[model samples]
Target: MPAVGFSPYTLYSREEWARLREDTPLTLTEADIENLSGVTERVSTDEVVDVYLPLSRLLNLYVEASQGLHGITEEFLRKGNGKIPFVIGLAGSVAAGKSTSARVLQALLARWPSHPNVALVPTDGFLFPNAVLEDRGLMTRKGFPESYDLPTLLNFLGDVKSGKARVEAPVYSHVVYDVLQGQTLAVEHPDIVIVEGLNVLQPAILPKDGETIPFVSDFFDFSIYIDAAEALVERWYVERFLRLRQTAFRDPAAYFHRYASLSEVEAREVALSLWRTINLINLHENILPTRQRADLILRKGAGHAVESVALRKL
Candidate 1:
C-alpha cells in the first residue's frame, strides 16, 4: 500500500486502459450488445472492445488465482471441499448503466473457458416487498439501506460462498415495482457470480458489543462501483423516465402507468422531484460514500459512456 497521502488507485484514461486489452479477442457482436443494453442505453461494440474486453481478461486472471488459492487451502487442510465461485459485487446509482455493465460482463466472462458458468444476480431482488415497505412507511425510501432484506441477502451470499449445490434469490419485477411472490432465481454452482445493486458496497453498522458483522461486500472476491457526476446521473434518470413514459409506463400493468399520460413538462418535473426526494438522497447518504470501497471504479461521462477507470493498486 502507498503512504497515507498517496492515492490507493492507479487512474487510467480511456486510451490508457484500452491499451491493457493487449490481444484479447472481441467475442460480442452488435446484436449481442443491443440485447445486453438497458432500455434507454445502448452499448456499442467499441465500448465492449475498449472497456469490457480488458475487464473480462483481468477478472479471468483473478478467478484463476482465486481458484488456485482455494485449492491450496483445501489441500493444506486435508479436506476436499468443492470449488468456490468468485463473488463480484457491482454497485452504482440508478440509471448509471450498471445493469448494462453487469450484463456485458456476464456475457464476456462466460465466454472465457475457465469460467463458462457465470451468473448475474441483481440485488433489487433482495428489496422488501412493496407491501412491506408501505407498512413500514418506507415506500418513498425504496433504495435506501433500510428498504432491503439484509439478513436474507447475507444468507444467500453465505450459501453461495459455501459452495451450495443451488441457491435461490428472490425475483423482483420492475413491471410491478415489487418482489414477486413464489418466484426465485436459482443460481446453480457458477464459476463466477456478479451481484449488482445500488447499495451493495454499503458498510455495516458496528455494534457496541464488538460483534462480527458481515456486510454484503464481505463475500466479494472483487467489487466494482460505477460512478458519475451527480448531475449527470440525475439527467440520465430523468431521460430514462421520459423514455419509459413512452414505452413501459404505457402498459396498463406497469407500476408507473399513471405517469404515461403526463405532459412532457409534467413528466420531467415528476422525474426531478423523485430524484430530489429519494434517489438523490440515497446516492448522497449511502451510495457515493461507498465508491472508494470498490476494487475498481468505472467513471461515466456523457451518453452513459465510461470515461475513465480507477483500479485499486494490488
Candidate 2:
C-alpha cells in the first residue's frame, strides 16, 4: 500500500489478503501450476492459496450479483431468460506474469459448482498475421494496438456476449510467430470467459466519421491489471529471452532460432536491445496508461510474487 492519501482503491497487503481466503478450498496441485505456467513465470500452490483463491471467491460474488441483475432485468422487461457469459479481462506487460494469473484464475473459477464452464482466451490470437503485418509495414510494431485485428476481435466478443452458442477465434503460434492458418479455437457457451492480453484495457479509438466504437474492456464484467516496476519487468524479459535461447529457440521451426547459437553476452545484449526498443515502449505508451481502467490491480514485487492488491472501491 502506498502511503499517500485519497486513493480510489483500498490496498491490502499479501497477509491481509490471504486471510480473506476463509473457507475457500484449494483444488489445484503443484503439477497443475507447473503445466499452466509460462517459461519464466511459475506459480506455487501457496501463492494460489493466498492470492488467487480469495480473488476467485470475490469473482464468484460478482458473477452471482450479475446473474441476479440479469434475471431481474429480464423479468421487468417481460422477456425470455437469456444467458450471457461473464467476461474477465486480464491485462499486463509481456513479462509481468499475466498469463500465469489468467491460467490460475481459469483453473480456480472452473472448480466452483455454480459456474463450471470457463474458457481462457489469449489476445495474442487476435494479432495480425506476420505477412499481413509486413504488408502493412507494421512488422516492427507488432503487439501495438494497431497491430491487432480489432474489428474481428470485437465481433467475436459481440457474438459471445449475445449468447451465441459457439464462436471461433484464430489460433496464434509463438514458435511460428504468426497466426496459424486453418486453425481456430472454438469457444462454446461458457459461464465465464477470461481474455488475457497486453492491451485488452486500451480505450476505443474515435473514428473521423464520428461513429462510436466499443473498446474491448467495454464488454468485460471485471478487469485486472498485473503491475510491477518497469526495471523488474525488463530484467524478467531479458532473463526469459536468455532461457528461451537454450530451450524453445533451439527448435529449427522457432522464429527466434537465430538467437539459439549466440553466446551469453551476445544474447543478453540482443534481449536488452529488444526490451529498450519494443516491449518497454509498448508498456509505457499503451499498456500502463490503461491501468486505471482495471477493476483490480495486482502489484508484483521482486521474483514475481504479488506483494499488494489494490481493488477499486464501490
TM-score of each predicted structure versus truth: 0.98, 0.96
Clashing pairs in 2: none
Model 2 TM-score on a 0 to 1 scale: 0.96
The 0-to-1 C-alpha lDDT of every candidate, in the order given, reads 0.94, 0.93
Candidate 2 lDDT (Cα, 0 to 1): 0.93
Model 2 lDDT per residue over 162-262, tens place: 88999999999988789999999999978999999999999987899988899999999999999999999999999999999999999999999999999
Candidate number of the best TM-score: 1
CA deviation > 4 Å runs, candidate 2: 1-5, 207-210
Native-structure RMSD, model 2? 2.4
Q: What is the lDDT of residue 241 in candidate 2?
A: 95
Number of clashing pairs per prediction, in order: 0, 0
Cα miss at 231, model 1 (Å)? 1.2
- Candidate 2, run of 10 with poorest lDDT: 1-10
